[model samples]
Target: MEKLNESMAWLAKQDGSLIVGHGPFVESSEPPADGTSFYVQDFALQDAKPWKTPSTVERTTIREMTMRFQNAASISCGWLPLDAAPFSVVFQEVMSSIHSGIFEKTVPVVTETGMADQPAGFAIMAAMTRQPLPLHSYGWIDGDSGFSGATPELLFALDGTCLETMALAGTARSDDREVFAVDEKEIREHEYVAQTLVSKLLDLGNIDRSAREILDLGSIVHFLTHIRLDLQSPRTPDELIRKLHPTPALGPLPRTAETLSLLFEWRNRLGCPKQFGAPFGLLDEGKFDAIVAIRGIWWEKNQVLLPAGCGVIEASRLVNEWRELRLKREAVKRFMLPL
Candidate 1:
C-alpha cells in the first residue's frame, strides 16, 4: 500500500503537460466492423481461444509490468484485482490518494448484469511514468443505456472559439439485449446527457454559450447528440480537459451519489488494482479531447487481464444491464477477434 501511495504522490507532481485521457477494450471476439477506426488487439488471448467460436469472454490477470497511463492503456485499476470492487473505498481513496474525482466502482447487482467480472487475457501497460494527467469529470444516471466506447466519438483540434466536447453515447445491451430507452423516464436520461454535456463543456471554457450549435460527427445514423463550444481563451490542455470529464454519462442524477459512494465508501473492501486502472486511459491526449473508454479490458501481465462493467442506475433494468455489459464487451471484441 505504501508503494501505491508513493507512486500516486509522484504522479501528482506536474512535470509533463496535463491533458485529458481514457482507455482499455472489449473481449477477443466480434472483430471490428466497418466504419469504426479504433480497434484494439487482445493478442495475449490469441492462442487461448483458437478452438472457440469467439463468443467467449472472461476476467483480467494480476501483477504485471504495466505502463499504461503515461504510456498506453491497461486494466490494472478495474474490479478484478483486490476484489474490493471500489465500493465506497475507491471514491474517498481517489480524493485523498490520487487527487481525483469521478470515482469508479464495481458492484454485484441483484441480477446478472453481463459486465465482465473475473478477467481473461492480459493487456498490461508497458511504458514508463510521466506526469500527472489533467482531469475534469461529471456523472449522471443514464435512465437509458450503456455506451459502446468510453466516450465513443472523440472530438479534438481547435474549432473556432468553441472547444468541441462531444461523444457518440453509443448503443447499450447486456448479453446483446437492449437496455436504454424503455419509456419516457428512460429515454429522458439520454436527453439529459445531450444537454448536460453542453453545459459541462461550457463550464470549462471561457466562451460564449448562445453562439453554440449542434454539428454532425460522422455517420448520421448513429444515435448521438453532439455539442461544440467556443472557448474564450486557449485552455491549457489540462484546464480544458478537467472541465469536460465525468459528463452525465457517469453521474449527477439521483443514483449518482449512491453510485459514487460505492467507490469511495466501499473501495477498500473491493481491493481492486492501484493506479493501474485509476486513470485507465486519460493520458496522452490531443488538444482538448475526451475519450469515453466505455468498452475495454485491462492488460495486466503476460497472462493476466481484467474486464469490468459500468452500473448505470436503479431505473436500469437488471436483465437489460446484463445485455448492456455484453455490448460493451463486444465493442472491444472487434480488434481482438478474428475470422
Candidate 2:
C-alpha cells in the first residue's frame, strides 16, 4: 500500500470501477457538462453548491485504489458507551406520533464517540476501499476531518432512461435470520419502504419490483427489494434525488415538511452527523449513481463519531431499537480491522 497525503473524494461504482477525485476541489451548483463530478450534500440539502469539481479525476479498479492506500498504523481508540435514556425518550415520542396518525414510521439516530491516539482518516479510508462486493466504498477527506464508509444501500443509479434503486430495511443478526424473516414487525417495516418507493415512481414509467429477499453481510443482514424504472422522459439528477431521498427506510413514513423538521431536531439532539443518510453520488457524463451515507465513521483529528439509525414504529420496542443501533455501529467498527 502506498501512502496518501492529500485531500480527496471517491465512490465505488457497481461496474467494478472506482472514480477518484483529488482535491483541492471547487464547488459548483451545476455539474460540468462533459466530465465527472461528485455530488455531496448534508442531510438537510442546505448546500447550494453540492457538485464538487476535483483538481483531477481518475478511473481505476478497487484493487488498484486499495494498493494506493498506505497501511494505517495500529492505534488504540476508546469509545464511550452511548446513553440510552435520550434514545428511549425519542423512541416514546416516535411511537406516540405513530399512534396519533402523524407518522407510520420514523428513524431516529444514535451516535457513539471515541478518541483515537492519532488521526484516523487513512486507516478508515484504507479499510473502506478493501471492503468486499455488495458494499460500495465512498468517502471525502480534507486533512484531519472527514468521513468514510462502505455502505450497502444504493439510493439510485441512473443510466440514460433506466434507473435502478432498492428498498433496504429490516435488520437482524445472521443467527436470527430464520426468526427475522418471519417476524411481523420486520416485514411491516420493509414493506413500508418498498411500497412507498413504488408509489413515488409509479408516474415515472414502467416499474419492476423484485421479490423481497435477504442481503447477508456476515454478522448483519437486511431485507432487500430491488426496484427499477424506465422513465417516460429524461429527468435531471437533482430532481430525482429530491423525489426519492429520505425514503421510509431512513426517513418519516409519510414524509412531510413538518415531520422532516421534527426528525432533524431529534438527530441534532443526538449529535448525528449532518451527512449521515444523505445522498452521496457521482455524475459521469450523464450517468449517475448515488448511495445512502450510512454505516460510516466521521472524524475531526483524534475525535471519532459513529452514528446509526433504527426505524421506529408503534410495534417497535425501546430495548430492541437500542440493541439494533449498537449492532449497526459494531458492524462499522469491524471495517477498521485488518482485511
Candidate 3:
C-alpha cells in the first residue's frame, strides 16, 4: 500500500507528462500528444459515430509507453468538452424516452459542477489509498487531460482462455445490505444488465453467472452478479470489449438503431460529454483487466469535471433520480475534499 502511494505521488508530480497508474501498476506516454492528438488505447474518440463500427488505432505496450514518458520533457493534455450539462433538460428527455417507448432501460447520466479551478490529483491519491476498491483505483494525467476514480464494475478480466466479469447495477443509499439486495426495482434493473452480458458471452464460450448479491462500497450498495466464461479458445481482449460495451448498465436495451438515437438525444439534452467513460479501459498482457469509468473527476488546466450517471426505467421518478445522482456524486465528493 505504501509503495502504491509512492508510485501515485511520483506519477502525479510529473508535470506536462502523460501517466496512468492503477494499484501497483503504472503506464505513461511520452512528452505529451502534439497538443492536438490524444493518445488513448482503451477508449474511442468523441466524434465516433455510434452506428458505425469505429476502427482501432494500435497502441504500444505499457512498458514502451512508460519509457517514452520518462524520456519526454513536457506533457500536454488532450481535448475534451469543458461545457456544463443542463440537468433539467436531460431529466425531461429521460421522461420523454420512457413515455415514447424509445427505451426500456437506459442510462442518462449528466456531468455536474463544471470547470472548477482546483487540482484534484492529491485528493485522488488520498482517496484511492484510503478507499481501495476491487475494480482497482486509477488516475491519469496527460499534459492537460486526465481523470481518476475507483470503479465498482470490472467490464472483463481475461486469463488465458477464461474470462471473468460482473453485472453491477441497482444503486441504493442504504447501509443495510438486505434492503438493497431484495428491492424489486433494483433486482429487475440488475437482471437486465446480467442477462444482457450473459447472452453476449454465449457467442464466445460457455458461461456461468452467480445470483444477484449486495456489493457494499462503503457508503453505497449495489446489486452485483459474477460471471465466468470459458472460451473455446483464446481470443483477443479488444474483441471482447467490442462485444460487451454499452451494456444495459451503460446504455439502453435492444442495442438497435432506434434506441441509439434516443440515447444520443438524451446525451445532447444533458450536455453529457462523450468522455463519461474516458480514462476507463484496462491493462492488457496475457491478462486483460478493465473497469467501467463511472465515478471520478476528469481534470485539465483549471477545469474540473465530475461525471455521474444513473439508469432510468419505467419505474424511475425524476425527483428520486435527481436525489440519487446527488448521493452518487457525494460518495466521491467526500474523499475529494480536504481531509
- Which candidate's lDDT is highest? 2
Q: Listing every candidate in turn, what is its Cα RMSD in Å to the true structure after a full C-alpha superposition?
A: 16.4, 1.3, 9.2
Q: Which ten residues in a row have the lowest lDDT in candidate 2?
A: 66-75
Model 1, 1-339: lDDT tens digits are 111110010011122322211212222333233211121211111222111111212211111211233333333222222222332333334334322333221232111112232232221111212211221111111112111112233433343355654433324433222333344434444555566566566555553323222222221112355555566566643344334434545433322545445543342344322211121122221222234333333332222222334344334444454545444444444323321
lDDT of 3 by residue, 261-339 (tens): 7777766666565656533443323344556666776665556666678888888777777767777877866645432
Summing lDDT over every window of 10 consecutive residues in candidate 1, give the lowest-scoring window.
1-10
Candidate numbers sorted by TM-score from highest down: 2, 3, 1
- lDDT winner between candidates 1 and 3: 3
Q: What shift in Å separates residue 263 of candidate 2 from its native position after superposition? A: 0.3
Ranking 1 against 2 by TM-score, winner: 2
Residue-level error in angstroms, candidate 2, position 116: 0.8
Task: Please provide TM-scores, in order, for all candidate models, with all chains considered together.
Answer: 0.44, 0.97, 0.73
**Given candidate 1, what's the lDDT at residue 62?**
15
lDDT score of residue 102 within candidate 1: 38
Residue 331 in candidate 3, Cα distance off native in Å = 0.5
